[model samples]
Target: MRDRIKTDELLSTSDLRVSTAATAWRHVEAEYVDEIDGILATLAPSGPYAYTVSPRMEEGKEIPTQRIVTTFDEIAETYQNLHRFAAVVAIRPVTQLHASWYTFVSGLGRGREKATGQESERPVIVLFPTMGSEGITGELFWGRTQRDSMPGDPADGSLASRFAVAKVHDTLLDAYRSGDVDALTDLAHAEIQAGLRDYEADTGTLAEMHTREELRRHLERFFGRYRVLGIDVVTSHYDDWFFFHELRWTVESRTGDDAGQTYRYHTAEYAELSAEGKIVAHIGHGTDRISAACPGPA
Candidate 1:
């Protein structure tokens, strides 16, 4: 029996993080600090690359502020810090989110904080995508997240095949991009549920839809407001039960106060699929700072 079963079959978990877009991030962070130059070379062009973190705030009602570090020089300075080299622990691969984009949560020790005897653990989120020859280009976020669960065993043999998940996902994306409501109806189950958790919104609302009819209405409202310029799947991961993908979208507002303005958004979504390969549940979250509004094409 052992000889007949494949090596992966013996493992209880289905984490493909080592093979996903997170590979370069894991490599760079795990290597000796002196190897930073070679690792930085793996990042995408420096102009667009960014590293951001949530500002430290006192325990209270004060809202957190964002501090972004751009430019290769600034990014290098942060990575070269001695404390930045601390070992990463408790890594959890967040799947079923971005199409081709992927992210993981891990803990890194912050060097000497106040009078603490030992380094304090800070949660870090490493978000990345495979950019052609750039390999794994990532945006490292420190102190943005406070908690995450550890990795777990794979689904109990109930997961769908990669091919099945990818096929439906591609069709759905095409339909969405084209505003093909009929095609979308064919792809969604009668009991479909969908929602968007727009983190960029000040209200922090998770807008939801419970049935195909509700989804249709929601999509109609969305299409009415914005004309999708493009949607590029940056990276993705899937199993029998869930398909996770990160996508970058460019759209122009058609009906709001911001009409005639274009914006670029980075979003992640995870969809739960039924046995028949139809989407039963879909949840999405906005992942990045939206680009400044620009004039739409004439």
Candidate 2:
């Protein structure tokens, strides 16, 4: 991804297949170069949100993880300071487990070393949510920065260690990829519903499914339109409340003007589980189409 992006252009899609929260985040990053005021407008004025950094090891000593509670003003100020020496080179919106929030992975470029001119990048995971009346009055921010050298979570008694949440996720994807409605039904909460509000689109326009049946029908239509070739999980983390993952997959159009063509997409997703371990909600924050090819063999 480029260091700078034109978000306004991407938000013009006539439908709500994409995410508003993710798009809003991209807008914030894109405006950092020219509109500090715009950045402020998108965030909540005050906050007690948690911001954590992944732990790293150096010289055989661990740089223990750290966290803080901060406000939007502090965040904005930090962004201003960073503008002097860094740029947001890439953004990958991850799926979120909460309806009001979103999460994403970002790459910060700190420019070349003064002497060696060697470039370096930092990876950051941000969790942000909008709150208040109309779900638009303000926004809250929280994040965890994962350094390039940070090690994976150590074995512990966390929920991830006690439950096979990642396996549940894998099964969910397998169900979808194989068009197994029975498996999909078994995995979802009865009242399961999902959506993304497209504030940029015409008012009253929404992309949502209100019940398990609705979700089923929607997937049936989708499966009819595209043949899912395969899905590969790139990375994932599971906790008590959410299962976060990154995936890359390819598909071929089944019946359409583009039939027979193949397309590949990379996405980040979040899933919420019910007490019975079924998925209560699943949100897709964003998807980036990485490539497309001409008609290919089945």
Candidate 3:
């Protein structure tokens, strides 16, 4: 059987680079740069560029791993070669604008169908921008087109509100990535609490606690055990509240029999956010498997 490695043993500078590249590849494919450029001509005059990291795959594994180094470099070269005039943007995940567009559309449809009687007949449409599109005109143009395509209804205002919530979600993720623990604590609502509770439970811990001190202590301990090698926001959704696409760090104990091994794990978390963009509750689910890597000491 293959070895089950711990995260701490394997996250090196090379690992970080590979992970970043792989994520960039995913963004390039999903956005379809060709189509994005066409859309940008209308909404943004500046050119846009994007790339994704190529996920790593084992020699005999059925499914490919998320170590996409090759893909990232390839996409970067492709962008530079094809769009000479447009600034070849550095590879990154889909922008907050894209996330807001997705959340708004998904929630709008669900909300319209849920209203009862007259309210049911009168659906709402919302328009919200999570980020300014100075770099990616194509994304901005596509976003506007998608927003305008929504059916006209009274709930338009409500859709706008949903966009506001998405903005909050994006902001919170940014703060968390920047290591702003205090900012994260202040922004977290029930959804974030719920998400952390789910994380604690999955890792085998206690119940939900509201105090910032408790959370800080818990996070400190967690980080000590497993360093945060990387974080990627893959997708997001908002119903009455907001949800996030979070990729976090996981590590294994290095003492005892299982020593000197490393692995990478992926997780998907659903969260409920407050009006101010704090996470109140969250549920996480995903497969926990060891990733392939070079042999090394723990």
Candidate 4:
């Protein structure tokens, strides 16, 4: 299809149906591009809240799996995101085709109802793409349940407490990703303890990064080796006085000679706050499933 819109001309949609009709615009890749690079948006004549991810199908599986690749939106949207989430995934078409398949969809996280603004889990769309004799074939799943949840009611404790931890959550995330050890130490207490591991793979008890100095050195070493490409949020929520977040991230190596090699990884982090809302303990687990081939090595 000769149809192509410069990224600037496109208005992000929240009601558009993602289907064969969108194939012509497959070149319309969003910055939020995923697997097959198919174009997906959420919009419809009904309103801005409607979302759809295409090749609507009855039964199928996501290929390479859908990982949270960015979290800025989750934190930016403040607990209500599903109504406006967007994503793309790779999948083998339910109807086999000689051509390759890819999908683009919107509405990954959930939004809250209007009357109460009380948040509840909502479904996001997953769309698929396929090439056929007729051109492009579509597969889609509707009402796919979402895993992210909003912070619990402040009535359980106090708005001050909830907001404090939420803010701390934001701050600590910033520090962790930026490798700002000084910021981490300032946010965390003197006795702060940190643990990191992989949820899907057991690498052992993790390094004993119990002291601020250890944490600083560990982060410095990590930042020295890999350059973070991007980070996506799979889930971000708060419970009691604790905050937790799961991320799907991509990082490229900058150390040694494999500087350009990229690795896809996922991690979950949990942090508990002291009575004063200072982070006391932080634990993280990560996994790198897909092996990346660096041109230089064996």
TM-score of each: 0.46, 0.47, 0.37, 0.43
Best by TM-score: 2
Whole-model Cα lDDT of every candidate shown, in order = 0.54, 0.48, 0.36, 0.44
Best-to-worst ranking by lDDT: 1, 2, 4, 3
- Residue 284, model 3, lDDT: 36
Better of 3 and 4 by lDDT: 4
**Once model 4 is optimally superposed onto the true structure by TM-score, how far is the C-alpha of residue 41 displaced, in angstroms?**
46
lDDT of 1 by residue, 172-202 (tens): 8898788788888788767665555433232
lDDT of 4 by residue, 1-298 (tens): 2345543334222112233335424422331243222222321212111111221223443211111211223222421333234333322222211112223333333434444555443333333333211222222233332132335456655565667668778777677667576887787655555555421122322333555676677666777777666666776665445565667766667766656777776665556566666665565445433445432321
Predicted candidate 3 versus true structure: per-residue lDDT over 1-298, tens digit per residue? 1233444534553454344333323334433443444423323222222112222345864222221111223444544443443322222222232231111121211111112212221122221111233222111011011112212234557676566656666776666545556776666442133213222224321233334465566565544444343455555564445444535433443344444344455444444444444554443333343643523322
Question: Cα deviation of 225 in candidate 3 (Å)?
Answer: 2.2
Error of 4 at 67 (Å): 30
- Count of clashes in candidate 2: 2
